[model samples]
Target chain A: MSNATKSVPDAEGRFGEFGRRFVPETLMEALDQLHEEYLRSKADPDFQSQLDHLLKTYVGRPSPLYFAERLTEHAGGAKIYFKREDLNHTGAHKINNTIGQALLTLRMGKKRVIAETGAGQHGVASATACARFGLDCVVYMGEEDIRRQKLNVFLMRNMGAEVRSVTSGSRTLRDAINEAMRDWMASVDTTHYILGSAVGPHPFPMIVRDFQSVIGSEARQQCLDETGQLPNEVIACVGGGSNAAGMFYPFVEDYDVSLTGVEAGGRGTQPGDHASPLTYGSKGVLHGSFSYVMQDEDGQTQDVHSISAGLDYPGVGPEHSYWKESGRVQYTVATDDEALEMFQLVAKLEGILPAVESSHAVAHAVKAAQKRSPDEIVVVCLSGRGDKDISEVARLTGIEM
Target chain B: MDSRISAVFASLKEQNQMAFMPFITAGDPDLAATQQVIRTLGASNVDMIEIGFPYSDPIADGPVIQASYTRALESKVSVSQIFKALGELDHEELPPLVAMVSFAIVFRTGVDQFLSSCVESGISGLIIPDLPGDEAAEVFEKVKGAGLDLIQLVAPTSPRERVRKILKSCSGFVYCIAVAGTTGERERVADSLLDQLKWLREETDLPLAVGFGISKPDHVEPLRGLADGVIIGSAIVRRFQELADKTLSSEDLQKELTKLAGDMVTATHTK
Candidate 1:
């Protein structure tokens, strides 16, 4: 990959016309303040040093880039590599952004931090950061998600954070985001909202993508060190496309390397049955930015289903939408059964229990490998561990663990 | 610049009365009931009507208004359906109609298409709470070309300079959020409301309409001379929710809305 260059987003936090501030007037000043602080911090060496220290020591950064020999042999084609973000402190890439935002919260002199989560990975990560820094934390989670991700809820509560169950709308990530936005509007004076992904209004999408850029940077360097060349393709699963954006942003300027984003195909390509926004959606504003979203003709968001709770969102990140439009990233989908098959295949062959979300990427990588020559290499971002999903998988397969 | 909204405010000013604007979620009880709600408010003494365009996610709304969106969605109401229902109403009977929709609803249907639909359905103005200041400049031209007023919001936290910039592009009337929070009922209006209104009055001559927590008739007394209008939303939606819970008839809901509308208009006569 070429040396770092700041990508498409302009000064106004726009990737073409996709990213803009569509929030209430009350939150405008706060967004401006955040944007200013972030720009200043981005250039400060001290801020970078401190953040790098925490990422390495506290969150256990520099996660491995492991070559999957068995998987490569099974596909009988390209060499497969896995960016092991599942080994992070909270078992997911979510800790990367939370650590950065929590530090920013302190810099802004805010005493409290709030966030919204779907599968509770972000909630746990945010709570962990707040607990480490001795700050107050509150996470809004959908009631349905709280039921499915009970273990993550317990982890968050154990870290001295308050978990509020949101019951409105579809009772999922979308509703939790609504509740969190309302909370921020009411308490913008003393609190900072730590958005979970590479989405939301201006500065947030840019900020999150920056924090997560570490993934792409580290993987790019590791792949060069190990193979003496850049990987042929970089792949990651896209919920709101944070991990994928993080893993792909650094490689975007590298024209030779391909970028593929896998979305949850759930049951099929039907709108309501799948969460593949980029595959089958129209351009509409959702969660405060214009992106590809599954909406009706009148602009109401449609309910999305996925075996992986983390990918059950109706919209993709604005930058991802832009990349897809520019033909930089080839987007694809993996169904529930395909992801489950990959999950079992990875666990049995590599002794790694991949999260269902990450399994989507594995499913696609396996297919891509079958189509490529043996000299080519593909890197799949292993976003999170599957311990939290073991029971759900067990129930689906009707097996006693 | 003279539109139905400005004309309504001008007529109210001549009568020495404050404009009473009542808000209701379209398709709350169903498309048929929503039609009745609009017609009921029209027959009342209110000066203008604000129809809440139901979106699946309304982040600017509190529990009462949020519940209304869910109920509206459950009834399978769409933006097209709301416009269809509004097309059936007689334009002569209704006051100037403003649709309080989200930006997504308009962008999804294509802005020009949405504005043209509003014109065909007799919608006089639009209030997108999510479209903050200066950002609306992009679509301001298209809105003007369609002869529809694009209402702008002025928050309590807005700086004086920001308020000036917003008013430069604002039309119909300025929506002054009574509090810094989402729409819901509050026991008392903020003490700084009068100062905020005074500051806004110095910025532009556009008629000011205070909303977002102005839920009761008594809330209008303090703003009688300070603002041109007061918008009551969540309180009215809460009343409809209570009736729906009890399985009451549409006529019962309309009757209650009429009484509340009358009481609010009476409160506008504090002088």
Candidate 2:
């Protein structure tokens, strides 16, 4: 069908040929069951109300839309605002999706939940939710990530989730995903795979985007109430594009508002240097969807490098690729240095430390605000708090704190 | 059918024997060694051989096969390289070669392009573990258009209606997953697999082969009357992993592979 309609992923989960259930024969029925349950759960008022209660009292909803007055003056053009997802429970936007999926797991009657994590934010969030719901939890993380994200590992383990280290190809996020899928396949009857991002097969991208849309809905109303109009630009950093999709999806029909996605430009434009697949990669299937992937000449997926473990992935969500082709959302890149600079600046100016993953969006917003008129407004999704990233930043910048 | 897969199954039927398919990851340890192993398996009593094209993310694979892919990929094995190496082999010395690849690899290389390369490389059939039902028809058509069989898998969890629909487009033999899990060695074949195979047998006259957790001689013994073929994958690949750790000579490695193939061949041949 046409990409113009906005209602995408028509029966077979094709976001204009970017998304599909490319999993094995065994999980097909599970995916079908999940899709059916998700639909029923969406329409069920009890599910909505319970999730709403958890979001309000447990995770804290309607996160404030704060005016970054100092950063706005620093940009010297447009007024800047931060959608404070960092203030939510678990110190990140990841909890938003995990809570919804945990509820789904219970609905499906699965007693165990498995997930893959790169930066540990999703793992911590999933573990936290599983702990609350009294379900068995397992988080597969790359050995390299476990070394780097020590705090998050401790957090996940403290919450009673088993942290399994993956020592496979690249020893990173993709490998963790592969391990988690394998685990899910072997334990499909008792387990639910809580995929962290807006990637993976059909229903997951839709599922995650719907769960995360709360960020956009809240920001939209909050922006209109605060500024008397919609912001001219909305920006969020994209790894698998969940946060960005959540923040941008509500504004798709608002043609006047520009939706921008910033990717990780790790070191340079050389192959394997960046995780910006949407900017420079070919279409291929990975995980369970056909999307833009960083692959080499022989179709082997290339290793992606980014200082931010969250964005160090070879592929983006299929919906992001579709939007890129549709020209609905403008995709850009922020180098590690740019993101790092923004990370430190936000802390010094606003007394708020942002995750390096979210700082990529802030870095782009800085540029976008500078290019816009003074009357225009920009809202940047502060996707997560940077407490977990402090050690990595210290190691990189040679500062203890 | 003129396909080598069908021909092999027909010959097996004539002899009152079951097909023995052994799986080896291409370029595991290295491409030369992988080719050597294939040549050895081909010369042995194997009716067919399945070559796994190593992928970064083999989601359907268990620990052993997944590790095999990692080792192969670490050695820089690519789809083009695998095909080129296979093309250099003397086809007469090899069993009918079937490729087991992930959809990402096929999609990246282009569907028609991948299938054509398989034809050029002497591949007779394909088993894409991740190309589930909804997208199988289009890919199966492309594989068939390239004059190759797109082998279908019937899992233990598949309902009768799903199995019936899957068998309709299936070519070669229907791959009956002996267990609900990914490919790995198991102590015993579950009794439920017989029921699944029995259900499939009622639906089609095509040959049925059991795989996924079929690893030992005992595993093959039980499937003698139930299945037309038995696939042994992770068990064989696990041997390769064990031998690689010892840094055995290439000839020795081939000998080990041949001996392993012989044992499974003997088991499948008996009764």
lDDT of 2 by residue, A69-148 (tens): 99999999999999999999999999999999999999999999999999899999999999999999999999988998
**What's model 2's lDDT at A379?**
97
Show model 1 residue runs off by greater than 4 Å.
A1-6, B247-249
Candidate 2 Cα misplacement greater than 4 A, ranges: A1-3
Give me the displacement of residue A259 in model 1, in angstroms. 0.4
Residue-wise lDDT of candidate 2 within B116-225, one digit each (tens)?
89999899999988887567988887778888999988887778877777776789889988888789988998999987777678898889999999887778777777
Per-residue C-alpha lDDT of model 1 across residues A1-401, encoded as one tens digit per residue: 33323466887777876888888898888898899999989999999999999999998989999999999999889999999999999999999999999999999999999999999999999999999999999999999999988899999999999999999888899999999999999899899999999999999999999899999999999999999999999999999999999999999889899999999999988778999899999899998888999998889999898999999999989999888878888999999999999999999999999999999999999999999999999999999999988999999999998
**Quality of candidate 1 docking, DockQ:** 0.83
What is the C-alpha DockQ of each candidate?
0.83, 0.74
Consecutive 10-residue window with the lowest summed lDDT within model 1 chain B: B243-252
TM-scores computed on chain B for all candidates: 0.96, 0.96
